[model samples]
Target: MLTNINFSARQALSGVISFSTCTIMVLLALAFSTSAYATAVKQAPYEPDVAAYRTALFLANMTPVPWSQINDAWADPISNTTDSISGFYALAKRPGGSALVEQIKQALAGKDTQALYAVTTRVMATALLEELSRAHNGLEDGSAKAALLRATALYRAFEDGIRFLDRDGYRSTGLAWLDVNSAAGSSGVLGAGTLETDPEKFGAALSIISDYIATNYAPETFTARLEFNAAPENIAASGASIHLAFTLPPGGTIDDQDPFPMLVLNFEEGHGIDEADLPLVAYGDMLFDSPVIFGEVAQNLGVSCSTCHNRSDINRNFFIPGVSHQPGAADVDGGFFNPLFNDHRSDSLDTPSLRGIRLTGPYGRDGRFGSLRFFTRNVIVNEFGGAEPTPFMLDAILAYMREFDFLPNSKITTDGNLTDEASDAARRGEILFNTEYKNMNGQSCATCHDPSANFLDRRAHDIGTEPPAYKGALAQAFDTPTLLSTASSGPYFHDGSQPTLGAVVNWFDTRFSLGLSKDQLADLTEYVETVGGADEPYQAFDDVDTKFRLAFDELTTFATTLNILIPMKDAKHALIMINTVAPDLAADASTMKNLDAKPDVYRLAGLLNSVASHIKKDDWDAAQKSWNEFKTLQDAVAEGMF
Candidate 1:
């Protein structure tokens, strides 16, 4: 049961959100604003049975609003809400559901948080599973059983919705969710995914809901997801701490947002603290969670890096006005289609997974930039009209992004190691990959991609992956992305033209005329999806200033790639970090730590700051004035400076 939340979105937002100035660090505090990507709509499946089952499934999975939104959600003003509350009651009335609805009603009516939590988590989930068991045995609608089983998953999702695990999907405090395998004692999706098949234990554990919920909800006992964060610094060193000023309590306050005053938590790595460079990582975490960093358009709609890239979800359901091709896809370059923004040509690209990004390079579908720093600044400036990143902020983000790893998979023999115990099918697929069948225009998959290069040749190729109407550069050629963790970032290709690895095989077969049989295609798909992410971190840069240069250059490249004014506020910070590390080098990559050059270096930074400030106000004359002075100083300090 795939759960999708559907709600109406404000339609008139795109026109208003196109341009405005905001810097990444400037808006770090606006982390928990309204969600911009709330399900704007639910499209029909065009089949009654499927739609009914889906509806039942979605209701079962809905979770509580963030604690801050509770009052607006449940207060008496519009208290007749029938969504989750009504859905639970309806499910309780289903066959074999028992009197769980009454228990739930009492819990809600009494405002009994403890009773409500238990009843909602245990009884309702249990009752639904029992009904689902009956459905599976053909005593009831099997579809309803199928739908009811999804309830546990929804309950699980509900818990997740409450926690909203932000620090790379794991938290040092609060409830840790259990995987619970399946009812048959198999590690699978919610309801153990086997309540019907293994009735003896599976059905019983669910039947008593309390039996299983007790183990799952035990406050102090649980497996910590994503390994623990780095420990705090030594006791003598200022007693490591971080400002948890933006935090919402585990379950949120009763009536309103807590406005967490002086809420400080230990500087634990998993709690927005990085043991390696605690301050840098904390700053990055705040920036990542901040929605105010984006232009007015994204802010008004409540979008931010975390909005799309958070622990709970990557927001595959996100949609924006005139920018969404479908639920999971966004047209990043609105200027290409909308004259009001910065009229250009249409260039819709797929969102890449941020995890394991260090291994997955040249950025974007075209492989736009070569590294994370480059890609990071480019996204800020172009996608959000953000102020340039300072050097420190860039490094801070660098530390944070380094924390992301590939989704765990066992197929790859070792982390980032392409070598695997090649199964017979994979071997055959490798043969097909290297073989230049005459029918394929003498093209071989291995010619440009193979395991030796992480299945990416670090180059672009044309396999004609374009629709008849697409005239963009990506339609003909696209950068070869890693097959590492290919399972998650799908519908494949620059435009998300293929939904699965098999679709890629099919496209090669039809377009390149490979004429491969079904068996061959299946073998190829097996190899691609089975690959895993690197087990250890991939460190790309050493000097913070040198990294700043690469990142700044990447942002510059984004401007040439397309015509638009991207307000990157990062450079001001970069300028400072550069001076701290290499004073005489301006932002260019030259080794010089001379104290004599500090004044000139800072002067250049001040000029650039003025440029950023002027750009924000749409004072192009003043912006260009300061920009030219900064550029002159940049060149005078060293060559290759921007």
Candidate 2:
């Protein structure tokens, strides 16, 4: 008896413990189910169509709906009819038709005029549909065909009615009717409205509408479109070497050089001078110290501003023309005319342009140069194997370049202030641009390119191996190009390796610099996307290749037409330097030092020396290498990285 009593106590204790454990398990499961249900409820209630309708409204430039009204309609359709229904009707009328119907009904409750009109349109359309259905017969007979025709006519009438309503500014009414019909179904019983007065509910609806508007209508907020055309053949036919010619404004002379009567003929026919064209002449004359002429002679010789810099409009294909130089081919003495060689033996080369150079700094293909003056000097001597200009000539060119300006009032701007959400995102991006928030390398935007001065450093720096082939000291040192008009200079990167600015920035972030956070990067991209284009149309080209050829011709013609009015006493110095010096020698870096003491003679002497060195070295390999290396170094120095 005593043992049994003791066992009962233990059993009771065991039972109590088991009951507690089971109760706890049940509670845990219930809690989990409730949490999951809550999450599903939160995410599942969105109506995609509703969101889209809101977006269409925004894009159509309709005024935003008031929060209070939106909430009232969402909660109780009948009572909120005045505000919500009117707003919905207005939105539907913007683009008109089915898009805004559902929203309109929810606000109007069939009582609004707009809603009634919409219902009438729907009823008429349905009647036409019913007629069509009756006309269709399984039997392929005359009656069936006749019925079909009648149905088609009725359908047309219904469509006409819809069009008439839209034109008469009753689009909101039609849309509201359609919405009511859809919700009521065949029974046509209007559902009673449920009033939801909570602010949280209203906020949710606003969020949904905002998200939809952002996704669908965001593109309409800004305006900047690009249009391109090929070069024209007739332009090339003119005596002008380069098919394309930029015009200058009246009274604008190509600096210092008295306006010549033949100047009109120098450019392509029908090409008139304009204010925009002045900068080109001003820049060219300052660099060449003579009015730059574009004519047949220049085109035939393949000489043009584009000869070294290449054309910016076209893909940066090398400007070597249709000819190629064979390894052992007769040396291209600067004086040689129409030299042709094996195409198979040619080497691919990079040919970035000088257009928009003012915006891009640390200039050059390799981004090795910092200063435009330095880069220009080096190219004249080393790359072109040409005579260097006198100090006056150099000064003129520098002055011209300094005057280079982007077309005024060309930047894109948003129509209105961005919503608070968008503004916040953009601000975040601005901060990222100004600070070092990325990971691979810690340099901020300023570390590489300074944003204050058109986002250029006017200097070159090492960007590591942008390409597998680009390695060693030669590729390592590159100039920083300006970012002013970078928005247009697509196929970004020194090698045109990246296709877009976003890619360029991303490459720098992930591969060169520390990678950026997705949000931060998005912000940066948004800012970049706002860059705009000029109002005037870009000059159309006839045949780009022909234009390219003309560029060469114009370049030669310009060179010949330039009258260097140096004193007779200094003529010999000019002649000896221009004629006697080997074109290669004039461009040679090693020989550059010998001519440096005489700055005026440096370009001519350096080019001559570079040419002489190549010829004497008898190794085209060494010659080309020297030329390329010197150019890289020159560009680097100009950009101030060196």
Candidate 3:
């Protein structure tokens, strides 16, 4: 796939370690002399400057790159640095930093997408070398240890590519990184248990990594192939429709800070309910929010069913640059999430609301699926590349989904008609809705929509919403979407081509030759809006801290399923339950306002993970014992956490 450029031309070798005989001999001698000085310890935390710079650099490479947010993340004030990128450039103190930065800036200024991506990624790979060199220069300094950590994080940018392109190289480079960490040693906190640095081991390990980078990602050898396995960078924008299931709107920073996004659930009722009262539904809710259900990229990014459908409603702000053509829409079978499911098409569809899902049958925009179970399974396995759900999991999800009632409406009656509170225009439009048209048949809008049946006829219609995919292809018959909460879920039609109810009415009026006047069109739009209206279209938010506390409690409710799973000896589901709840507990705890309660929350997560380990060992008694401890700890911290 790659044509070789010169192997040794224009190679930047200043920071690289040459494997000359004398150099190798010197390194080996130092390593042996200082071997006794090296000691093992737990890994240290990454510097925020390096972390922020890494995020910003990756963001800058994504398709339809979010330049503004990348800039903000780079210059995040909380980093206590004017710009993380600049700070890192200074820290590395290596030549060509200014030139690389300028190249990225120039490419961005020119709006040259490919050039910017290439240059930005080159900077990411090269920065790893500079940090490693900086670490080697000062092994005993605390900052040197941090430099080593930064170098490890930076290598991940190209880790995948290296594995794919050269497997043996991957193993060597990976092991060398561990060696470097061991060689660097630990300074320890408060002058306790400090391990002195081993210069010999550090130099030898440093050479392996430096040579690997030089041969693959140096100035002369660097190519796009080296970045093939890089992590996905197309994160949803701050105001994008894609949101956290239980989080507040316009979710928080990636770091999880105060006033950050918090969970905001919306069931049929205007208030929250106790999940313990409906155990199966509660388990289903947990499954909906658990990203581990999906494969690779989705799981890595923490995406789940609730990402697109926030609180059972469509997430209007959800978007991924390459996968989504617009906010609130995504090509489920696109190459972004899973190439196995790519249909070789750009058919991004509008995400439908899950509210009143029980009444809406013949799932999918094309109405190709007859059973909800089959459709749900297809979405998991084929669409998002998730594992096939167990029957119990499926049943639980169905039970939870069936409980999704439409938002309450006051002006509309049970028969799907407006009451006396309706405007005169709506009443007039209601007549038109039921009136027979004679374009080619004596059918009316109500014939297909069926107002009394929650505004759906449970049928597909070839009304020419769009052309067939190819010549000789069958007419595209789209499922009739329910109008129950249509007013709140805009951008109508299968492809989201219509932006409003009025636009939809206008399209139909023109398409079917409805020969209606302007006033008549307005009336028809009004009628449809009335049928779709709800008292409150979305859930109102509580303060961030309160939302986090509610989420903490809800997570525990999700864990209650462990009681049934363990008793049934269903280790599979039990382990799934534990894995799902544990990570959230740790992460959510980190963002809690009550710093004092953080430790207990972390302990709760650790205990749950311990339970999973016990289940893996087939120790039911141990698992149960751990679960009980987890519950006890939860109760203790319940009153103290945010």
lDDT for each of the candidates?
Answer: 0.44, 0.35, 0.66
TM value for model 3: 0.65
Q: For residues 1-642, what per-residue lDDT tens digits would candidate 1 score against the true structure?
A: 112211111112322342112212222323222322221122212222112222222222112212212222222121112232334434445554446555545655665333334444455345434544543354232353354445443344223322322232223212212222243333347756444434454444443443333334322322321111111111102222211112121111111111111111234323565333354554555456444455544553445575555431244544432354444556665531112234233455666656655655777777767887888886667677556776766786776566665554455653233355556776666677778878766767766766666667778766666554555433566787667655655667767778788888888888777778889899877666556322322224444444345333322222221112224334433333222222112332222244465566557646655655665576766766776676566568645332
lDDT, ranked from best to worst: 3, 1, 2
lDDT of 3 by residue, 1-642 (tens): 122312211111210232334324433332222100001121233343344444554444333345665554434432333334443344244456666656656655665444544555666657778888888887755567878866876675555445433446778887988888877787679999787778999889998998877555544422322122232222111111111111101111112112222232344254566667777888888888776677644664566787776666676666654456667888897644554566656678988887778888888898888899898888888887778899988988887777777777787987886888989999999999999999727899999989899898999989999898799999899999888877877889987889999999999889989888999999999999998887777545466536557568768898988888788888888877776777777767755678898888788888988889989999999999999998788777676566
- lDDT (Cα, 0-100) at 77 in candidate 1: 20
- Which candidate should be chosen as best, given lDDT against the real structure? 3
Would you estimate the TM-scores of all the predictions?
0.42, 0.34, 0.65
Question: Candidate 2 overall Cα lDDT vs. reference?
Answer: 0.35
Residue-pair clashes per candidate, as listed?
A: 22, 80, 14
Q: How does candidate 1 score on lDDT? A: 0.44
lDDT of 3 at 311: 63
Candidates 1 and 3 compared by lDDT, better number: 3
Off by over 4 Å in 1: 1-32, 35-277, 310-314, 335-341, 371-374, 414-423, 439-441, 467-475, 532-642
Model 1 TM-score is 0.42
Q: For residue 14, give model 2's deviation from the true position in Å.
A: 99
Model 3 worst lDDT run, 10 consecutive residues = 33-42
Which portions of model 2 miss their true places by more than 4 Å? 1-301, 307-350, 353-371, 390-392, 407-428, 467-475, 512-522, 531-537, 540-642
